[model samples]
Target: MMRNFHRWVGLVLSLVLFVAALSGTALSVVNVLEAGRAIRPASTQTVADLAARVQVAHPGLEQIRRAPSGQVSAWWFDGGQPGSAVVDPATGRDFSSADPDPVRRWFTEVHRSFFLGDSGRIVAASGAFAMLLLAVSGTILAVRRLGGWKRWIARLRGPLAGRLHTEIARVAVVGLVLSAVTALWMSAETFEILSIDEASIGAAPSPSGRTGFPLREMEALRALPASSLRELSFPAADDPQDVYVLKTDRGVGYVDQGSGKLLGWQGLGFWQRVSETVYMLHTAQGAPVLGIFLGAMALGAAVLSATGVLVWLAGWRNRPRIPANAPAARADTVVMVGSENGSTWGFAATLASALRSAGHRVHVAPMSAFHPSRYPHAQRYLILAATYGDGDAPSSAKGFLGRLGELRVPPSAPVAVLGFGDRGFPSFCGYAHDVDAQIRAIGWR
Candidate 1:
């Protein structure tokens, strides 16, 4: 029963999942293209070098925004950066890519939040929930077929997509779940659900008796690399009170607006900094090294979804009818069947054909299709049921017990239950026993 439910639920979400994966993989390669666009060959200058350059150009300014790539910008305003520059990759010379460019901001917003704000948050949360269901549902079905966790990932006999589905699912389950949960957490955080203390958000600068320093150090700045800098937020104003904000993946720091002296600093919490790290890894953001591998797996996923749907639809469309090809009361054979994937139906039909020449009434029907009226002339009855996960009945047999209660069968008729299954499954022959008990309960004992 659970197996069929999982499969059907997955069918509904598979299309959405395929689309999301494709778009996400595309967005990951943005960095390579952006670097190509810069035309300067993507150079990285140091903090010391940028500080020296900015100090010389904006002597009156209290703060300078130094890019990891050696591009410099000055900030002394409440709303935004005062000015900016970029380094030419070809010449190792300074140029300008100016801050607050609408293009960059627009792309960033779209990629991060899809520009939908609250609506986007809800949609993302829904996606995460859907993904969680996908992982769990896949896991439940896989484990049932393979029997136990010991051999869950072992080789199984099935079509190409079915085989790949199990194997890829084994390897991808962890990453998939992590991505989903992280997405959920991010959605919650986006709406300010996390408790935030105003003190930690921002604080006023401490009193510094020494307002300015004459000489600034360049060694540290010169050694900095563009790859290390995540973002650089400029100072608020020209007032000596303002400080330059230097943000790295590890922490944040303030430097003297005038002298470039390092000042206050705060280390971001471990998990807080980890947000970007996992997001990049999960989405493949700006990382092309894994491009081929991710692309291949994504294609495999698409194939898996498409084939799964086809297999399911074909089964549903060609399901076995209630009555088998047999005349009334004359034949001495009967076949009772239970199946989730309908693989058992083929076996039942084949069995009926072999017994035809022997002059037996071979009845083939789902467990739910069982009724006293169908076996009017049966001398012997055989129950063929396939056990589902953890010794559970197949979907076709879930209600068979209740139906047996509603209808009483003739007494003392010879009856036998035969369960078909692969030994690899732990629940081998399990549910067929339950069906036998149901039959015995109705005076077949």
Candidate 2:
């Protein structure tokens, strides 16, 4: 049942998941490029030093912001026109113009909201949730196929599509799960369903109506190192009532322009820190190497989705359908099947048809529905079982062993157990072996 659920969900959501993965991969690449081009300042420098240097270079400086990557940017009004640039903290020189990349921005928007704003975000979140489900189900299926968790990395023998899907999923599951879970977390925060403390700087102190003190001498700003600075908005040049607003990794604060005294501060709450960490990990904005690794995983996810669909289509095309199958209670020969992907059912259908052609009453049903007492006139029983992960029962056979144990009366009919599975698996036909053993223990002939 779980195997079928995983397959159908992947089939239905493949396109959306593909688009999301592709866009995410592209965004990660863009982040890497942007990180490479950013101008990083020395760790020992202070926000005060950067501000002082920037003020000298651009007297109209209005704001200085630090990216998660530790890159500084400054915005200012030049000749009554607003401008912004990536800045060098040491010299306060503009290294690059703040021109957004259209392609990256477009992908970002599509990735977050699919260009549909709020509705798109919900869609994106759904995709993420689907991906998470696929990862979990796929892992369970893989473990069953391999015979056990201990042999999870064992070699696999199967059709090309199945093998490829399993291989890629084994390596990429961690990253895919991480991405999906983080995406959901961020989406919850976006919708205001998860309340995270917003950084707050208390009311600004009343300006003294005097020119602000030297940036180098501002005690509050001097205490904040460049490494900790998130953003620093300077007081407006024309407004005496305005005060500098400082945001750092620890919290937010307001600094009096005239006295340079720290007016109000609010430390970041635990949830706020958690949210920021999740954002950084999800976006890989602070770590280029991690970004590249996740991008490769996203690419792997795309491949996994394609291969999974192919495998499902192949299984569906090959599964057999029986016509005019005999009723379970009236048949003399019962063919019970335990199939994960419908393959064992195909074998059962063929066997049942062959038996019926020989003038024997044959019925085919899932192992879970097996009832020896129901086949009162049965002469023989044929069991076709497929082993899933870790020698565990497939969805169709989940409760069969327990049902067999509960039988009040053992049948005297002859029984034959047939196991179907790849030889490369550590516990080949494990469930079939269990079925055969259980039948004997129950006193079946």
Candidate 2 lDDT for residue 105: 89
Q: Model 1 misses residue 353 by how many Å?
A: 9.3
Q: Write the per-residue lDDT of candidate 1 for residues 1-445, one digit (tens) a residue.
A: 5566667666876665565455444443444444344432235655454444545555434444433223344433323445444544333334665555565456545534457777755755675577677778878777766766887767675445556667777776665676567667666667777533211225536524344443335222444654455444445343667655667656676656555555666777766656666555555534555444454444444555676676676667546564457753454676777876677877777777777656666766677776666666777777778876557777777787787778644534588888866555555677887777777777774
As a TM-score, model 1 comes out at 0.68
The digit string of per-residue lDDT tens for model 2 on 20-82 reads 998999999999988887788788898889999988888999999888777888899899999
The estimated TM-scores of all candidates read: 0.68, 0.86
Q: Candidate 2, after superposition: displacement of residue 250 in Å?
A: 2.1
Return the top candidate by TM-score: 2
On the 0 to 100 scale, the lDDT of residue 203 in model 1 is: 50
Q: CA lDDT of 9 in candidate 2?
A: 96
